[model samples]
Target: MTAHGRLPVVYFPEADERLSSWAARMAPFYAMTVSEFVAALGLKGHDVFDLEWRLSEGQGALIAARTGLSPEAVQAMTFRELGAAARMMIARKSRSACPHCPEDLHRKAAAQPWRFRCKVHGVEFRDATGETLSDRFGADCFKKLEGHAEAGAAHLDAWACGAGQGDLKAPEVLQVLTARHRRASPPNVDEQPRMSLKDRRDYQDFLTTPILRQALTVVVPEYDQAAPVLAKPVRPGLHALAQGSLLQCFALTVGIGRIIEDPVKWAISVMLVSDAEGQGRVRQAISPWPLSLKRRISARFWRAERDERARQSAEKAARQRQSHKYRLIQSHKYRYRIS
Candidate 1:
């Protein structure tokens, strides 16, 4: 189709490919850098940097002539023409590229913060260079987390969507639940303000063990089965493992409805006090904890809640001040307007 009578490489952009990524792929086939390829097409200046810009009909025709693709095909690859969902999921930074993606194809879905796995490969998505914790802990250890992968993904999606909608209560419950579980775990001897490499490796190993996995399993069982297991006498050095597992389960299972109902108070009361005292009747329950421990946990939750409320109040005040200033400025600007 070109005046030189040479056809460009017959390459079709992948569904997830960005305009720049597709150009990068085509550049290698033509023995040119991506910048050079853009230059060859007479797309000078900022046009080369405008990766998401829609191609005009003239621009599309010119690109088609040089690349041996239909003008429509080039337009299809442009991001500005993509549907709303696709646009929302587009990656602005190159770091969003999936390292494990075959042929180095950038994925649009990878742009979502909640998307941790490459669905096609069934592997956790690594950074742009394709590295993961498995490189250090070994593949076997990494596989432990994979067992809960489906639930974890769904939980993350729900949490992300809820957070995006300004619903903070669910996330707050998750934070409290995880903190309680983490407190039950044995203290790391190497714990410091900043963890050393050894401490990090040890922590990773700790999380991958069977004890934690068993605790997470408790979440899926019915209340009767779960209560008996939780009631078992705590063994020395195993408290942390049990707690960590329970925390992960709560994080992955607690829904917005439970959060709205303020179940944290009921759950904590039940876990720390026997049903006879906390519920006015004996029921399936964990052995009561020391009164002091119960008070400490309750106080921590209240303190966190108070701090969050203060933070929200401050933000609202700031917004109101800004709005008032904007109205004042607008009123002055309209002072001389004709009545």
Candidate 2:
């Protein structure tokens, strides 16, 4: 545990663009046919999605049922069509937070409330839900549908795992070693200005402080529980360095593979290693954004920047009205002499 005995939050494995690229190469098929593939891969029974049987299986059925097509009908749909449907279905289900309270109200309100207040909680807020919630037809119905989903299960993990429930780990902060130490650059030459020898020594000592080591243990349970296959017991500092180095090597391999543009191989590596959560931590420590979000975010940012510029222009006009030039014009009384 950390010095304060808290564990770090972990995220589920992200779908990789590299893997998606490989999957995209599959021959085209109808949406129903693609649904069959999904069913087959997940070993789902045809009745698993039956409306009559839906309640027993719970909210997952809500997603499947939204298609209004039976599992068999879904199986008959084309892959290309199913691809669009699948995206809509997923985006539909992701929880929408209340525009007011932190609680997710599940896309209940459509137009900005009279004062842009959330109808449910009557407060103004913005988050993933508020941003992604559709402004179109689904906005109202989806809110009710999502409530049904929530009634079935409180969180994604619970929904996925089913009836024998338990709490999922919440996000926490823990200390970790500053494994890599680079030489301080000359004062004027680099971003990290030079530090004195004593300072460096003091920093090194801080890294080894007992509280920090405890934090590492708290954060990374795997380190305490799963002994690395190292031959000897190394100092905590050395251990951190070794683990960090391996993660760096794996990242480099990923980079090299990307440079070569080998999607299949990249997919294989990602799928194979995704289960090793500790390694995921190491990867995140080095580079936070994975490929999928990176690709999608660029598109989001383009639109966001465009909208921001529009907003700024409007605001600028208002500001100009308050300026001296505008004031002078407003204050000036022009006498129109009829010639």
Candidate 3:
């Protein structure tokens, strides 16, 4: 059985022919034949058919290097014991679906993970509530979604489980999720539309529900939290909501009317969710509606205020000029004007 945050266990019957095939696929990577690889691993007291690791490919590679194995072998091993290792990995990778709403603003500044409580409606994941957000996200997707670690753990897990839902085939799922999120978002008065705290909460809640979350879990069974030594930090916008980087840019769809501008660049950034079928030049990159995005909105408001001020100033200046001219004419005509 799978334990939370551990690799899924595979229970391939000893008599299965796939066992030999699994070994064969892994042999070249490990510099051995199927029999040699199995014998080598078995000699090392590792259940070659049941070995498991987190979803980090680098980590898997590291483990393989240390064990004198190859990347392919490590992955194959994860798949071979797909029963127990896979379950353990998934349980450990669940993320909290709660939205920290209004107060979320403050929590983001402190940069603390657990300080914020549920501020928005429908932020709760449980209808269990005992599970911490950390526990919910487990260890895998939590890091990647946050941009702290890599984002392909789900693909790796799929491979290990023989789930046939690897990197090449996972976009459809992401597209659907992204679409749902887009449809629920409301338009703003300005050119750019930002998701409100309430909308984000509702969408997040729906995402964590069993229907979608389970599908993701099936497609991506294991995740890794460790970042590679050279891995770059995640951009603030792409960072997940849990990190308080709202308005993560997903897709850049064309403006049917005036609502959307810069469709080409926006679409490129969202390439993760779109496929060749929807491919186009990046019109613009729509990032999360953070302070930066709000600047434009604030600027528009400021410009309007400034324009009104300018108009009032002009009117006041004109009145003053008229008064001064009238006073001068009166003074010229009558020497004792004040009296």
Candidate 4:
């Protein structure tokens, strides 16, 4: 086999391996950049990262032919079957370090928000701080919150993967959680003021107020003692967060889980409290909740209103009957006195 041919060596794709990961791993072995490597494999017109989601049959066939991998194996590395929302959750690079994985070869689980463990190893991933969730959160926190964290992770996995078919939509739920609270105390930290202008990223936290962090405390009182932090304060959705920021992801999902379990209370306690500072910006998130949820909440209030009206009408009719009885009693007494 020539240097460029089906030649030298081939690496089979790892289980739950990312398309980019498989390609990147092979690229260095061949003394080619990832682009150069795939180009040599009779591939063109699509970026390697893009192929992580959109690898076509033709593209898969080209890769499978050269690498001795089945087309199914090639396709498994990509997330083409996942919906757009789920696809958006993919991290560009592995967010956490897995003890079991080879250096720099990220598994698909590493890039996915719904998973916090190394898929192959079944152990937790070490995040940027070089700490597992237990290391970062400490013994007490790890014990108490781990189950909640797992619950939240399962909620997101189900919602993102379309397995739950529940009323909660993760993005809309996050919108409510992160919505600015009208009555929240100034989030201005003293240290925040002293930071210099050149280090602009630090200022990003201040630009967006401390909403999710504070809101999560309500979701899980266990988090009340723990100070909340955000990688980037302004987030449009969970997918928009810095992928490796597992701390934020954990808190966000935990809050989402609690909200999913009880949306009305979440809306009243978390979303409604946000500043009506400007008309109904906060209310907007509450308003567009999937119709089933909105109806459930509305139905509860509607029943209360109907019950109150019925009670009032009953009281009024009783009062009229009592008045008539009193008048008849008075007339009978008057007639008896006359006789």
Candidate 5:
């Protein structure tokens, strides 16, 4: 339908260019909209945007034949080669953009959370407002997690590409990191009665956030000193973060590296500072860890539980003895009836 009976217009896909981007660019040459161009090719029930990640071989071949490009080249323009892991991490819309490239020429990697730089230009990506990862985390603070993010990014990229199926998956690591380590501390500011009505009411609302007087502070204990303030009982997990902002992805990337160093140690250390519920949460959260690692964690967890029970039992006995002595003293006083 496009330039009928004439030779196909020659248009090459940019390196790492998304299939959607190529079709869009070529659409105007034939005076057709992207959707019309795709429809004319007979790929019905297929969204133009999804072509980046979900194109079938038949569809790829059809596009190739119409565009005068090989099927392999057409497939390369999609996420077909990146594997499903990258598919899960790909944002529905671009999260960051390359400063040097035109908006229409963004690469496929730009939509992937693991990629911090432009695959085509080798430049760091920036948010819509021109904020880079370094800016979100100040240059000095970013320096702390940058190394971990780099190494973790590589590890994650390799794992997603099916390189390390035997190792722990990224989602498990993130959930384990989210296990609450420390109880929430009282807000730094105090709520005193007799304050203005507005102030007192605000304070009341803060404390009474439907609470059993427990302020649950869910956090990554290792990043306690640096991570941004997070909402209570809400920890960063892979699903909550797969399409997250650059900063969120960066944090998870650092966490992936930090825990991989000694996953068991991190789990135990987090358990130590947590309450009974928090500890139990960790015990359950680690169920997906590899078998050998799971055994080691379980052994340590049971030992710690036994020790805590023994200590509590000893304290209960001491309290009973003290209560008995106090009763005897009261009976003696009643017998004497002295002033």
Candidate 6:
């Protein structure tokens, strides 16, 4: 191979690997930046920017010749052939990468917005630049959360395919679920220290929106109302918050999964439907199920909602009674002479 042809053999692409990530890994073998590598292939401007789109025949030939791979192999590696709806699932930003992966290997699935942990290593995914999003947070929570992501993805795909009728858009559903997670587990000390004051305040507001709170309650019937802690300094609340966030995220995904037919099958397939012991874990993950075991949990949630309304009503009545009594007292005082 010539000096210009000194590219690494294309790393075997994972099921969901992005073409961009593959290019990034190949860049080092050629001793060039990813952009430089793509530009050298004669792709210009926007073509270089959009790696998911299939390369032109000439561009494919150029890369094939340089890498000593067939044009068919080059084409197979690109995600550009996937349907438009499928492409939306790929995150535009490289949100996470696998820490345990070889230096030259980055799993494309990790970069997807819905994925939380590395499938192979069972570790928390890192941010685009390969830094932990929260040092205090552990991978265990994310691993648990990932078990439910398949269910979430199913719902998302269904919606994208126009299978459901709902007021919420697909993006809104994801945002609401993420907000629920943020609320259930507010940023701990490790996460807060990295944020600016304004960002912290904004994050607090984002988590506490009325819609998010309602969504949280719907998904997690056992959820308790936790007051915002933005005014206070960050403290050591990592473990509890991590666990809460994981549960919340998983609950939200299960709730989304409930909309599909045969929800139990969907949930089970996403989790442990095969193993008997694992089935118990799956049940625990999707507890307070408004779908599976609907009668018991649904009744419980209804009772809780009724009790909340009654409590509010009692409080309003008590305030009204006090106001009426005060008015009567004032009337009597006005009728009588000044004491």
Instruction: For model 2, give the 10-residue run with minimal summed lDDT.
Output: 168-177
Work out the TM-score per prediction. 0.39, 0.19, 0.18, 0.73, 0.72, 0.48
Which candidate gets the maximum lDDT versus the true structure? 4
lDDT of 1 by residue, 28-118 (tens): 8878788877767656453543644567777778778777777777776665533343233334433333455655565444544334456
What local distance difference test score does each model get?
A: 0.46, 0.29, 0.33, 0.68, 0.67, 0.49
Model 4, residue 184: what's the lDDT?
A: 46
**Stretches > 4 Å off in candidate 2:** 1-290, 321-326, 333-339
Across residues 1-339, which tens digit of lDDT does each residue of candidate 3 receive?
A: 111222222223121122334445456765666556645543334443333322257645554544544566555534334434233222111222344332112211122112112333434332124543335455454433333111233343353355865223222222322332121122223312255878767666433333211111111223112211111122221122223211111110001111122222223233333333322211112233334433554465456557767989999999999999999988887877656
Estimate, for each residue in 189-300, the C-alpha lDDT of model 4 and write its tens digit.
5324455676556666564554433344455554444443334233645643444267667667667777877887666555423444521555576676877777776666
lDDT of 1: 0.46
The regions of model 1 sitting more than 4 angstroms off are 1-7, 47-49, 53-104, 111-113, 128-339
lDDT tens readout by residue for model 2, 1-339: 122221132111112111111112221232234234324333245432231112223333332353233443323221221222122122211123344443221232211111122445554334343442223213564343333233322222222223333221101000112211112122222212255878767665433332211223222223323222221122332222223322221122222223123322322233222334543443343233345643444455456657777989999987986786766765563422322
Q: Higher-lDDT candidate among 1 and 2?
A: 1
Q: Residue 312's C-alpha lDDT in candidate 6?
A: 90
Better of 1 and 6 by lDDT: 6
TM-score rank, highest first?
Answer: 4, 5, 6, 1, 2, 3
- TM-score (C-alpha) between model 3 and the true structure: 0.18
Error of 1 at 39 (Å): 3.0
Estimate, for each residue in 1-339, the C-alpha lDDT of model 5 and write its tens digit. 653332367578888788788877877987978888777666656788788787788888777776678889888887765667556777655668889888777577777777777877887788767988677656777777677778778777777677764467877776776555444443332322356877767776564443111111222332333334332233356664575666656666776777777777666666766777766777777888989998887788678778888999999999999999999999899888975
- Candidate 6 local lDDT, 234-302, one digit each (tens): 111111212223333334554454433343333333332124443343344445344534444345545
Cα displacement (angstroms), candidate 3, residue 263, comes to 5.9
Candidate 4 differs from the real structure by a C-alpha RMSD in angstroms, to one decimal, of 11.6
